[model samples]
Target chain A: MAAHNTVATSNARKQVAAGGWLWGAVRRNGAGYLFLAPWLIGFFCLTLGPALVSLYLSFTNYDLLTTPEFVGMQNYVRMATADPKFIASIRVTLLYVALSVPLKLAFALAVAMVLNRGMRGLPFYRAIFYLPSLLGTSVAIAVLWRQLFAADGMVNSLLAQFGVEGPSWISNPNYSLYTLVVLSVWQFGSPMIIFLAGLRQIPVDMYEAASLDGASPARQFFRITLPLLSPVIFFNVVIQTIEAFKAFTPAFIISGGSGGPINSTLFYTLYLYQEAFSYFRMGYASALAWVLVVLIAVFTAFSFLTTKYWVHYDD
Target chain B: MTDAVHEVPGRASTHPRLTGTVRHVLLIAISFVMIYPILWMLSGSLRPADELFGGDAGLMPSQVTLQAYSDGWFGLQVTFGRFFANSLIIAVLATVGNVLAASLVAFAFARLKFSGQKFWFALMLGTLMLPYHVTLIPQYVMFRSLGWVNTWWPLILPKYFAVDAFFIFLMVQFFRGIPRELDDAARMDGCSPWRIYRKIILPLSMPVLATAAIFSFIWTWEDFFGPLIYISEMSQYTVQLGLRSFIDSSGTSSWNELFAMSLLSLVPIFLIFLFFQRLLIEGIATTGMKR
Candidate 1:
């Protein structure tokens, strides 16, 4: 690894040295860095550098006002053993991701298929559906979600029409998280749009051939559509899984930032926020952030590893 | 000077009319499902709080009034106007910065060849996977140390620096997609590289620029986390942060007023989207599936 790193570094250096008149060319390419400079500066100052700093901070005890004191692996150890909320948060997050991802993808695929059928005013339908996904995870919609799921809100009144009294979805612990799941599923537009595009990319001739083969609609979908769409499905899965794990706004708005009604809706990021800002447990939150990174990386790696068997990239 | 066009289809139609009718019906049904929530939200906003949840039968408002709108605009904590202004300023600034900065970087990435070009590009791509949460606390701490909190600096400054690699990457792809022949032709006509970019490339990239502008505007306007962490001063709050504060405060929420405000929040986004919905959808859908 060291030898490879050195070789790559030396090769880079030699290229730099050999390019004497290439300075003009280098400056042009360097201008790209200039365009990218602000982002690079931000990455170092705001994101990347901070990420490394946070990892270090996780091994220390630090609040905003005071200097950080090195505490070794105590934060991690304590979180693993003593933190009940930590454990509960993990369960809640996994459940949220697991429920939200498949439902969102399925809904998106179904809707995309519906829209793919040579619909009139296709743009209008696409905009309307995609609007929610664009605005869905926002604090405004989360606020709207709270009102829509309140005890005497629109949902309960609709339920009353069926003579099935509905619980206050956001306020009630039993149903609060379910409202969030519904919220996630509602924003299925982004993936739906992608699926629609992917569907369009699939040759119409193939479907025509399937029909000629006397294949039923269901049979054609199962054999042809499913196999071809596997890559898109896998892409949506990875992206949605990452997104769901980071979901914070809804739980915050619905539970009033307490992660309340017995911590049923305490998502991992919310818990992390509570630790960092609310409880002043910056070290713990830092540790939690790192853990989330690991979790996401591991899952992402696992998906990539398994993609050879499942994901059908045409190329 | 009149030209007449005529179509002659002489029994060449093969697809069934029943299939077309069935497809239309399915489409209408699908559209209804998509539109219902937004329609519900809109209708609900026009009613009084009590009437909003009155029943399924009264889904439409009985006395559609501007009371909620006025109350939303003036009476409440996040009195719509200030938040709107804040959101507008942030969004416009972010859009301007992204367009100017991302375009320059994208030009470099697409057109320029230099040492470590591939490595730098890969680095940018690699950084895309680093979730914002990992950097949230430390950024807060860093900003706090610099006393940049309770201000828009944390939100706005980072954006100017091209912190959003997504936009950079998006613009890069767009820039790459443009024909290189235009640059060569411009150069042959004695244009500088900068002149080539400004005169030729930029003019042709209007659609992509518009796409980027719309996205940056919406994303910045809707952003919650950055503002939430950085801005503690109620007066300094962006629209999203202000809206959140409304939910955070107890006993202050008039459901009708909140819904009305929510609707108001969506107006600019809605209008922008309506005007460019086709382009936005196509742009997002195509770019998304590419990866």
Candidate 2:
């Protein structure tokens, strides 16, 4: 009985100590917490909460009007087996990511390298190049792109001077996706700016030393420039690839929201939008959303995992 | 030093003047190609509808007219002026909210010490890479349930809450660059953290604040998907939606007018870009390099 009484007293003392620590922490962090309240509220209400709810919704069948019914991996199964549109979207999106990202990065790097050469009017050139990236995602640009790729549009009209008739690029499934890729590549300005910044960080003496050693410019680029720029390249690759995956407007507007010409331009996000908003398959769309999340997570993780092999750090 | 290093090889191989001329020519050609489409669109908008297509590929209108612009402005039931007003209100509110809330959150992260701060910051960065689609559906449902489906609240309210982690990250980086001695001096004067944030930090953070505001306005103005999903009412349409409706409702019949309105839609962004080019470039460069 005396031992039990001692234990109860110790427990009470511990509770008081814990409470005091909690109170002290609150007092110490009150101002910080106050500053963070808005963001904390947004994070909880909008991002994290919605993400968790979507994960749950992915397992159900919901249409916004009806209560969600548990489906137990049916959406996943259907996507793998039954849905050809899903397959087509995955194929198109993968093709886009595979094509656009490298091409954009290559173009960006090439431009950045050229501009890095102590050229006059660097700001003028940079601004001109960056203009496309700023306007690339707007509806106006998408509308312009459609007209520019129409059968009798500017591209074909330009080609007409060579006496070669270009097909309606926007309508041709074989070429529709390529038009989107070109649009993505045209916005290489942002990445070019990034590459230029990265290039600026490289020591000029390295190049001078390489030149002194009789290394050709090409040789110097491969040996010194590439290794040094690998981190920036990796960053651009991951970012551009993810962006290429999420590309919707150009595809949506170009395809007229149909993902047509046999789903050639059916970007994953476009397909997801159609399913959720157009078809009101909220649950299935949630599942699609999760799949995208997983795909991006995997891609990012894979990039990180593979970084040691190629991405170099000064440290 | 860089100029000298760059000149050394050029001087050895060829005349520096000759190389400079060649470089200028190459850059000029590339710039022309880069901006040709916009120039072409501008020309198209100036031409009569009959001459819009099947014309020469050159960016010069045979006969310029303001017919397309006037027609486009009053083409829809709700004038393009209304859409511009709607877009301006939303963009301005979003920019103000983003700059204010993001700065506040960024101040906390950069200046103050608190428990779980590291974890929260990590989570915030994680959201940067997390695609919007994951939370998109649930957010739609939430907004719809709150009857925000056809309102600008869904568009503008999120900004007030600092959902744009990119701006927060950008501001945090800028804030860290600020010397903390000022804050310490303010504290020595018995100023509170809020006072220091207002007096010391914000006053010194004009560059980053301007950067955030410009980007936020441009992005909000260009945002098609958010307004597309939330707003279906034609009268409440933003500029992007208004332009899209012009395409759907008129098709190719009013191509010149479409081009005119499209060009008009881009004017605000173009003006901002024209003025804030330096700030925009610096913002992107600093943030990108710091990464």
Best by DockQ: 2
Question: lDDT per residue, candidate 2, A1-315, as tens digits?
Answer: 999999999999999999999899988899899999999999999999999999999999999998999999999999999999999999999999999999988998988988996688999999999999988789999999999998889999999999999999999998999998899888889999999999999999998788777788799999999999999999889888888888888888888899978999999999999999999999999999999999999999999999999999989
- B1-291 in candidate 1: lDDT tens per residue? 122221112111334455567766776786676667667777777887565354552457887888877876775454667888888998898889888777877777787665677887888887777778888888888788788888887888777777777877888888888888888887788887678778887898898888888888888887777787778877787777767666555343476777777778878888987788877787777677211
Q: Cα RMSD to native, each candidate?
A: 7.4, 3.4
The global C-alpha lDDT for each of the candidates, from Candidate 1 onward, is 0.79, 0.91
Clashing residue pairs in candidate 1 are A38-B161, A39-B161, A39-B162
Q: Score the docking of each candidate (DockQ).
A: 0.41, 0.61
* Docking quality level of the chain pair in candidate 2: medium
Best by TM-score: 2
The candidate maximizing lDDT is: 2
lDDT of 2 at B57: 85
Off by over 4 Å in 1: A1-32, B1-23, B49-57, B188-190, B249-253, B289-291
